[model samples]
Target: MRTTMKLDGADLLDLARGAAFLGTGGGGDPYVGRLMVQQCLDDGLTVEVIDPLDVPDDALVIPTAMMGAPTVLVEKIPSGEEAIASLRALEAHFGRRAFATMPIEIGGINSTIPLVVGARLGLPIVDADGMGRAFPELQMETFGVYGISGSPLCVTNEYGDSALIHGRDNKMMEWLARGAAIRMGGCAYIAEYGMSGADMKRTSIRNTLTLAMRIGRCLREAKDRHENPFDALLRLLPDTPYSYGRIIFKGKIVDMRRETRAGFSVGRARIEGLEGWDGLMEIEIQNENLIARLDGQVRAIVPDLICIMDSETAEPITTEQLRFGQRVTVLSVAVPAIMRSPEALDVFGPKGFGLTEPFTPIESIV
Candidate 1:
């Protein structure tokens, strides 16, 4: 079993970049998180990533990330210590310090923000995350699906404002925290879904931190070797739980509608096919890409990844960054077997988002 890994130089950046890809058009941009981690390194900080199995069963592990509209995040950048403050608030409420910090979801900034917390606090970042991909709401995560409570969640914004929220359920927690975020200038950092190491082993997606890094490494190295980056991605994913990676569509954004509403960025995008591809593909969003349809037939849906990237550079575009006339390729990957369970689907699948479409795997639908 893997014990630990040290992130420095390109490792941190690759992890951030790959997270941007896995984010599936949510989790906000990794660019800011990458810069923060790089700054930590510049200040002679070390980011130690520990395997979840190494965590003691009794230890408290808190997953930390920024929560709110990704569109709002672009304008309201974090002050870097907001998450740490959130964690401290949790610690104060629990009357015990945290054993480690981890990402609640695998997305651009959320994927790397915990590393920033870890380096600043001198704690290890667990190589695990609550969700394999980003989701719109806090309740839509494996942590909640598998019975981890999302409160006593601590929400904090820059300028030292903070609130510790408790809820009867994860959905209630999301509602309360999201309202807090919107009131706090539209974005806030959070530390929530606190659980024991045992809870992590049972519910969290393991090794995703390293997987995100490896994904970035593959794309970067492939480019250096003058190979197709997308081909490198397809080759790399099958070996992991998120498998069956394929190009679902090639197109240019013909039209897009996006807005920051109710503390979430909600919208849809239409991509007209190019490169011998025909028809149009539509991707609906609520912070993250939820369902993608090609010519009105579902090719991918929630719980599976529906990623849009720069066709030439393979750079993942968040919902906020999406625009008209950009050449993009849609890559769909199957989620881990755990995320597809009927119980898990109830919280994060199509029905979870109020859609009538039955949950279907990318391989089956495509």
Candidate 2:
């Protein structure tokens, strides 16, 4: 049976933490999103999450998210209405009121921003998302992989500026949105990849929101009980599509190279293995952790998730936050089944990121 859940302030906090871990070192930071949701809850707003199956088959579903460099989002916070404005613009263009809202990704700020928009618009949020984890490009979403067009996208900035693009395909949508975001001062709110409820149920990574919440709750409860939070996280993985998790490396950040370029935080990071392991690891970043190498061998790659967390606290560290000399544990999780399909891989696989090495599942590697 399908079930629904209401999100309170406490739930938002847990959601943020879980989303950060799932972000795989991208999706922007969740701090701004948490603050926004907290303010909404303080005002007594009700944010309800509905199972994708519970949505009417013909209902119009709009997926909303932030587009641009993660670092830029930190410096320029939203006006709280950018998403709403984009949604309204889409509603006008489609000539139909949205029946519900869903996150484009269930990671970092993108996860919580949808909740805020749902609360403000009095709309139910689908308990699913486009990317099971965070990805950098618009065409990387499951919606795009499943043949949903991202055209007629509406983008808005904090200063009340908005742009609507009618693209031929999802790739075109990404190019247009990237250029538009750069023009709008590096960050913008986007409402795109609109689909019907039936299509959403078929294309979305189901129950990702609940998965994130459970991960967060497990970590929090583990800490409360003075148990290992990483162990708690591993225990919960079997219940989700991400059935595997492993700490592939433990090290201290020795170097990081990152810059906000062309609307993306792009660079690499190097870490030296600590505590008697004289190995080194390297990570490629483009808004999110894309690839990781240990001792000159590829350990993880994009479309799969590579997360770096505080070794002791288990808190996720974003790509932009990687600092010199901070102890960290790098973990990798297998992408969901839907993302492993031949077509899905074509869009998010190693080649999609311009890597010569072929895509390999994290499970097979670890």
Q: lDDT per residue, candidate 2, 1-366, as tens digits?
A: 576898887788788889999999889888889999888888999889999999998999998889899999888988569999999999999999999999999889999888889999999999999999999999999999999999889999988899999878889989999999999999899999888999999999998888888888888999999999988887788778998888788899999889999899999889999866669999999899988999889999888889999998998888878898899989898878999999999998889889888888888894
In candidate 1, what are the lDDT values of residues 270-335, reduced to their tens digit?
999999999999999999999998889998988899999999898888889999999999999999
TM-score of 2: 0.98
lDDT of each: 0.91, 0.90
Model 1 misplaced stretches (Cα beyond 4 Å): none
Q: What shift in Å separates residue 47 of candidate 1 from its native position after superposition?
A: 0.5
Q: Clashes in each model (backbone N, CA, C under 3 Å)?
A: 0, 0
